[model samples]
Target: MLIVGEIHTALLPHSRPLTPEEARGALALAVGETVVQWARPVPHTASPTLLHGVDCRLPLGPKPGNRHADDAAGGSSVRAVGTVCSRAVLTGGHLLQGSAWTAVAPPQQPRRMPWSYYLARPGTLETIGNFEARRLAEGYLLADGQGKGLARKVRHDGGTALLDAAAIARHSVHDVLSRPVLDQRPPIKTGSTRLRWAAIADPGEGRAVAFRLVGNDRRRMSLVTGLVEPEQIAAAAEDLAVHDWLLSAVAARIALAKIGEDPRHTLRTLRPVVDHLLHLWSAGARTSRDLEFMWDSLERRPGLTRQWTTMTERVRSQIDYGAADLAAKMLDMMEERQKQTGGAGEPHYR
Candidate 1:
């Protein structure tokens, strides 16, 4: 079985973090389903699972000798039928995430199954023909408009492809973003982070996860684990996406400042980090034991928190310098005016 998923992370549009009650209302996307909330690690709220039925050709990568052979394109196009799992999450009641993924299993029958059959197995996609976990995962994570050619064609012809997990996640985020509950004033001026992950079933290998920073835009990760469920993998990926977003968002803000720009304006730009984003760097807060290793591996090599601290300190120093510089300039101006006025008496205001 191959489990593939994508996560979209962004700041909640609200001026202030939403309370548990507000988050519940914001995440109410389905009937008879409850949004789960946890308070200890962070004020986290998750919408109930949303499923999208997918019945289209599996996207295969191009093969060396043959032009249209790989699983990404499927020489002639092999269809994969299954339900994609999606959900929205609020972290610290401030960050919002739309996550979707599907587990691909070889179909029990030789042909397309009934919709009821797919619906019965939520979050799983049954493919009719050849299914290669690595190729599918790579194709899904390929940079925008790259490996999507085959997947796009299948969706175009078949009307729906289970492999379009990213689309489901993007739409979920858009739904929350359009709601009136969130204020128009954005908290941080940053772009959203897209993370794609695939967990390939590894019999007796225990659980090990690998993280890769791909194409300078997206983060891709893979998990080779023993018998772990897909939902658990999705949750871990969600957590990773959130923290990774926080880091990337902060870094982008820092990089946007021009050395020659007005210090006050730069201060204004960095203020959001302190006010809204600094307290959001909690890693592995809600990760499951099976996926904790993934977080640990990433933290060790990239040292996410370490980099965050360095950036935070830099921002804080700049803010302090800006404040002091402004104060010194004001004082100098007052002294110059005093000299020009020959130390005149204090003026009275109405």
Candidate 2:
């Protein structure tokens, strides 16, 4: 059995005020710490993985063209759901199950010695919210123990209602956001441009669609956005150039590592190098010069490549260490800033 839990931090002030940036940062830190703490005891069960953080806000009511059919059928007006700051799944072993001592006892007991202090920080509230959202999003209605039917309740009912793992697997996030609805469908032609160029065969809708094209060349990288309506044509034509580029880079790295007389057999050797590239790309370091620098540094010296691996590992470790460090630093910063402004102890703005 998989045991899942969530933690949420309230944006609204309870005792002290926080800026939006500070609140967001605090929320992120709290979620990170909670996961680390949960994973500590279950070393064998938890697999190492990267975490993706999502901050989303769903606005109330329909956009200009798309209105919910349910509303026309006498449903209540849709309202904006509150902002959600959450982390995705942190999959691990069944350590939380089977033994009350390992599962309940540790969490119940004060690992840090003072439970009240843990509850006192507004950051704690943010942590809880993220955990709850993760639970609801991943655990909904699959009957798989990981999903607890929570997805059913939290699911949106309009254009976004049908969005689930299947849809996500089929479409990109950008596509999902830009999908057109029958109610608020744009005109077939807007000015000289045609909106619904062709009909989608699979979904059988003649609706227009937006496609994000990501590609890279020797000189530079590019992300071209296009609009198309035909379902199959759109899916196929949409450039996954960026993903392809990244994958090619990985393949190239693997090939290079295999070139020498003493070939590296294990993925562990290549994992760090690939991870470094991934980090750079994610950090918006897309220029050819940056990529060339990374490639050259890795290939320049064997020791440097090893050092790159070690550095990646160190940074990963710092995620846990840095959370604690950040929390403390933030507290100090907030306190000093508050003092300078002569508004110490005031609750943060909502």
The 0-to-1 C-alpha lDDT of every candidate, in the order given, reads 0.77, 0.25
Candidate 1, residues 46-68: lDDT per residue as tens digits?
Answer: 98898776665556555546644
For model 2, what is the alpha-carbon lDDT of residue 280? 27
lDDT, candidate 2, equals 0.25
lDDT of 2 by residue, 235-326 (tens): 22111222223334444444444423332232334544433344422211222321233234323543334444554554344444445565
What TM-scores do the predictions have? 0.87, 0.17
Which predicted model would earn the best TM-score? 1
RMSD per candidate (Å) reads 3.4, 26.0
